[model samples]
Each structure stands twice: as C-alpha cells, then as structure tokens.
Target chain A: MIIARVTGTVVATAKEPKLEGMKMLLLQPTDASGQTAKGSPVVAIDAVGAGLHDLVLYAAGSSARQTEITKDKPVDAVVMAIVDLIENQGGISYRKG
Target chain B: MIIARVTGTVVATAKEPKLEGMKMLLLQPTDASGQTAKGSPVVAIDAVGAGLHDLVLYAAGSSARQTEITKDKPVDAVVMAIVDLIENQGGISYRKG
Candidate 1:
C-alpha cells in the first residue's frame, strides 16, 4: 500500500455503473514524513470514508478492487485505510491527532 | 492499468500455497515511449504468459486477485496482458511485432 493524503474530490457524472455511488478523491502520494511525493496525484476510489487532508493507505491496481465496495468495479486505486500515525526510523514521521 | 516491461524473474520457494506454481517477474514501469519509468522496479505475479523484456499490462491492488489464478491469494500485482503496440498522439509509440 502507498501512503497518501486525500487532497480533494472528483465527481464523474458519466462512469461505469459499478462506480455509481463510489466516492472518488484526489490523492497525493506522501512519503513517511507526510510530504508530497514525486508522482502526479491520482484519483482514487474512497472505501474508508477518509476526509480531505486525511492521511490514508491506498492500494493500486487489482488490489484496489479487493474492497467490498469496489468489487468488480473498473477502479484502479482505492483508499483502504485511514492512518492515525506513522513512526519511521524511530522518529515520529507523522501524526493525525 | 500501468504499462511495464518484464526485466527479470524471482523464485520464492516459501510463500502462500495459493501462490504455488505462479510465476514472478520483476517489472520496470514504462512510458508510452517504452522508456523506464521513474519508480523502482516492482515484483509482480505473471497471470499471462509474458517473457523477459516483454511489455505487459499489470493490475495492482485487490484487482490483482480478481484473476482466476490469483483469487484468494495475497498477491498485490499481476501482469494481465501482453502488449502488441502502444500508439499515442496519432503516433506509434511502441510495438512488439
């Protein structure tokens, strides 16, 4: 899984039926320090009800569909977990609360 | 799906039983021009019969398990298609044959 931040939202009126009620969020991949990663942001299906700026754990490719909400959907990325904290290299890299 | 080139192979004798007999390949993500992508090479399970240096389409996330061979497995990435060509901007960006 990749650590990312829910930067924003996306509303696609025209999409596959399987994605009808799924929430799409703009995700900015983040390093352990919670800084923006190098790659361009990706649009991911929100499965864990993460809010804007919330740190999240997202899965890409086929793994994105493993969630019950995204099963059989054509979605390629999904926010699977809401991260509360991240400790890296014995240092507090990030914390939500 | 992301486009990638199979670079090498991996042999893991100890793994989940569901992964028995599955082929693992090292993949280098590629651009439309077939150039190496920025991220580090990833280890992916081959769902299709792709060869070394073969350009392939891979799905990551839960979708990786959607295939018959990977269903219920802990795999995170799968090579799903062999690419014949990649045409971009009205130009032939890549071709296999």
Candidate 2:
C-alpha cells in the first residue's frame, strides 16, 4: 500500500462493465509526511468514502481488486483506508483534518 | 501491470520464508517505446525467466502473488511476461533485441 491524497474525483459514464457505479478518485502519491506529492497521480476506486484532500492508503494492482466491491474487476487501484495520522521515527508527521 | 526492463539481479540470503529460492530482478519502468525511463527502479520476482536487459511486463501488488512460485508471498511485484514487441499508433515502437 502507498500513502496518497485525494485530489479530485472522476466522473466516468463509459467504463468496464464490472466497474459500474464505482467511485473513482484522483490520487497524488505523497511521502510519509502526507504533505508533498511523491509521484504521478493515478485514478483509483474509492472504497473508504474519502473526501477531497483526505489522506489515504491505497492498494495497487491485484491487491486493489481484493476488496469486495472491486473483486474480479478490471480496476488497478483502490483507496482501501483513510489515514488518520502518520507517525515516522516516533513523531507525528501528519494529522487528518 | 506495467512495462519495464530487467536491469539487474538481486541476491538475498535472508527474506520472507515464502520468498525463499525466488529470483529477484531489478526492473526499471519504461515508456511505451521501451527506451526512456519513466519511473524509479523496482525489485520484482522473475516469473518468466527474464534475463538482464529484457523488456518485460510486470504485475504489481497482490497480482504479483498470483504466480505459482509467489503465491501468498509478501512480494509486491513480479515479472510476468517478456515483451516481443511494443506497437503504438499502428507502428512498432520496440522489439526484443
């Protein structure tokens, strides 16, 4: 899993049949501090109802399909957990608002 | 899954039990042309006998565990297929050397 921030939402009317009604969000990978962007943004199915600017942990590849809602789906990424806080080296790096 | 080139090998004597005896290869993500480097290099279990400098396709996360040798393992990446050719816009962009 990787830490990311939900930056926006995607509205797709035409997609894989198995992905119908799934919520897709734009994720920007973040460092452990959850503030700075780390890599390219990716589209991911939202399983945890995370809102914009929310810190999240997402699974990529087949692990993204492990959720009940994404099982056997063609999706390659999923927001599996909403992060509450990030601690590194025994100190708080980020706290959700 | 993504396209990458097997750049090198990794020798590990201590690892997760399920990953014992598995060949780990260093992979560098590539563009569709398979020439330009796209992202940071990653370590992936070689499932298709990929050799050094071989252009290959690698699955990430849980899909990496779908292979027979890596099933239920802690590994997050696997080289699943060796690329024969990469065609984009109806033209060959890359071919195995």
Candidate 3:
C-alpha cells in the first residue's frame, strides 16, 4: 500500500442503500517523496478509526468488500490500518520505520 | 467516500503478477472539515492524473481487480478518479463543490 496523509471527508444524502453507514474520504495522490499528484476524491473506508492529518494505508476492490462493515456496501477503497512507521531495504526512510 | 489528499506513491520490486505497470498512490484520510486522520498506506489504482495536494477518488476489492492493468493482482485499493469538486445536501461545502 502507498503511504498517504488524511485530507478530508465527504457526505452524500443521495446514495445506495447498502452504503448508508460506509465512511468515504477524499484522497490526494502522492509519491514517496511526499509530493502530491494530480487526482480526485477517494470514497475510502475507515476501518481503524483514522482521524484527519494522520498518515494511513488504504485498500480497495473485493478485499474492501470483505470487511464486516462494508460487505455488499458498493464500496471499493477501505482504510485498513494507521501507519506509525514504514521501513524497507532502504532502511528507515520513514518512521512511526 | 471521504475526501482525502494525495501524499505520495510507492515502488515495490516484489509484488503480485497482475500489478505490473499499475500506478499506486499514497493517501491521507480526511474529514469534511479538511482534517487529517490516522491510517497507513493505500496502494490505490490511479486512473486520473492526480498530483500532490490534489483530491482523488479510489476504489477497491474485486472492482480494483477488474481494471485491465490490475486484473488478478493482490492489490485491494485503486485510484479511480480525480475530483475537481464535491457538492451535496450542504450546498457546496467543497469546491473544484
């Protein structure tokens, strides 16, 4: 999963029935350099109680549907975890690494 | 979907087969108030060309696998669109609303 920071939230009164309780978020694309990219909103999931400004990792597709809250909710992306650190072969490029 | 901002992207030498050439972006979770939340990485499918600080929309699960580039990949999140604006019952709380 790509590292990201929380930006904002969205609300929709007119939507699908199964999507009632689902939490959707708007995401800005970014790279490892911590630079933003060109993109739009992402109706992502909030599984781990992510708040604004926190860096997080999100998932999508059928796996998103696999969540207990999102099952059959017409959802695609779901916030699965909150990142405290990130490390790799590069050795401690990011921490919380 | 919640509104989020793009933070960064990722590169992995070891990954799934169907994920070759797929663009993955890092996202930060946000609320309607434009606040960041807690979370981890979000390896999303990039459809629209979104840069840093740009808002984007992403999908997940089997639908992410439905993409031509991500078919059968182990990926779960995919960036589907770049949001220019977001409007709702609140009467344009967010713009580009």
Candidate 4:
C-alpha cells in the first residue's frame, strides 16, 4: 500500500467495461508526513469515499482488484482506506481536518 | 507492471516462513528506453530465471502472487519476464547484449 492525497477526479466516458460506473480519482503520492510529494501521480479507483485533498491509502497492482467493487476489474490502483491521522516517530505528523 | 533491471540479490537467513526457498533480487526501475533510472529500487521474488543486470518486467502487489511458484505467498513483487528488446516509436531502444 502507498500513502497519497486525492488531488482531483477523472471522468472517462469510454473505458474498460468492467470499470463502468466506477469513480476514478487522481492520486499524488505523499511522504510519511503526508506533507510533501513522494512520487508521480496515478489514477486510482475509489473504493472508499475519498474527497478532494483527503489523505488516503491505496493498493496497487492486482491487490487493487481484490476489493468487492474492483474484483476482477482491469484497474491497477484502488483507494482502500481514508487516512484519519498519521504518527511518525511517536509524534503526530498529520491529522485530517 | 514495471520495467526494471536486476541489480543484485538479497540473502536473508530469517524471513517469512512462507517465503522459504524463494530467491529475492534487487530491482531498479528503468524508463521505457531501458537506459535511465525511473524510480526507487525494490526487492522482488524471481519467478523466471533472471540473472544480474538483466532487464526484466515485474508485477507488483497481488499480481505477483499469480505465478505458479509464488501463489499464495507473502510477496508483493515478482520478476515475471526477462526483456529481450525494447522498441520505442518504431525504433529499437534497447537490445540484449
């Protein structure tokens, strides 16, 4: 799993049939502190109700397909959890607002 | 899936019991040209007979567990194919030496 922030949403009219009616969001990988960018941005299926600017944990690859909604889908990334808080080295690094 | 180069090997005397007898290799992600570093290095199970310095394609997350040898294993990455050549825009970008 990777920590990322929901930056935006994607509206695709023509996509894999399995992905029909699924919500896709743009994710920007974030560091442990959830304050800085860690890697490139990726598009992921929304399993959790993640809103814009929300910190989330997403699973990549086939694990992304393990969810009930994404099962057997051609998607490669999925938002599995909405992060509430992050603690680093015994101190709070980020708290959802 | 991602393209990477087999950089080295990992030797662990004690690891997850399910990972017993598995060969772990260090992989460095590469660009489509197979000549530039793309991302951080990762450790992946060797599903194919990959050797040091070999360009390969690897599956991440649960997809890594789809192989016959890695099925149901506690692994997140697997080298699934050894690249022979990489063609970019109708041109050969990389060829095995």
lDDT of 1 by residue, B1-97 (tens): 5667789999999888888999999998876556657467999888667889887766677767766777789988877666666544345667674
lDDT of 1 by residue, A17-53 (tens): 3456777666667898777574645567888889887
- Of 1 and 3, the candidate ahead on TM-score is 1
How well does model 3 score by local distance difference test?
A: 0.60
Candidate 1: lDDT of B78?
79
Q: Write the per-residue lDDT of candidate 4 for residues A1-97, one digit (tens) a residue.
A: 5668899999989888988999999999886556888779999998767889987766677766666788789988877666666544345666777
Reference-based lDDT, residue B52, model 4:
83
Q: What is the DockQ of each candidate?
A: 0.09, 0.07, 0.14, 0.06
Query: Can you write out model 3's per-residue Cα lDDT over B1-97, one digit (the tens) per residue?
Result: 4455678888887977666777778887554333455355465766556677666555555665544455567777665455555543234445543
Candidate 1 lDDT at A13 equals 39
lDDT accuracy of residue B80 in candidate 3: 49
Using lDDT as the measure, what is the rank order of every candidate, best first? 4, 2, 1, 3
Interface root-mean-square deviation (Å) of every model: 9.3, 10.1, 7.3, 10.6
The prediction achieving the highest lDDT against the true structure is: 4
- What's the TM-score of every candidate structure? 0.55, 0.54, 0.50, 0.54
Q: What is the interface RMSD of candidate 4, in Å?
A: 10.6
lDDT (CA) for every model shown? 0.74, 0.75, 0.60, 0.76
After superposition, the stretches of candidate 4 with alpha carbons farther than 4 Å from their true spots are B1-60, B63-97
**Which candidate, 1 or 4, has the higher TM-score?**
1
Model 4 CAPRI rating: incorrect
Total clashes in model 4, counting residue pairs 3 or more apart in sequence or in different chains = 0
Q: Which pairs clash (backbone N, Cα, C closer than 3 Å) in model 4? A: none
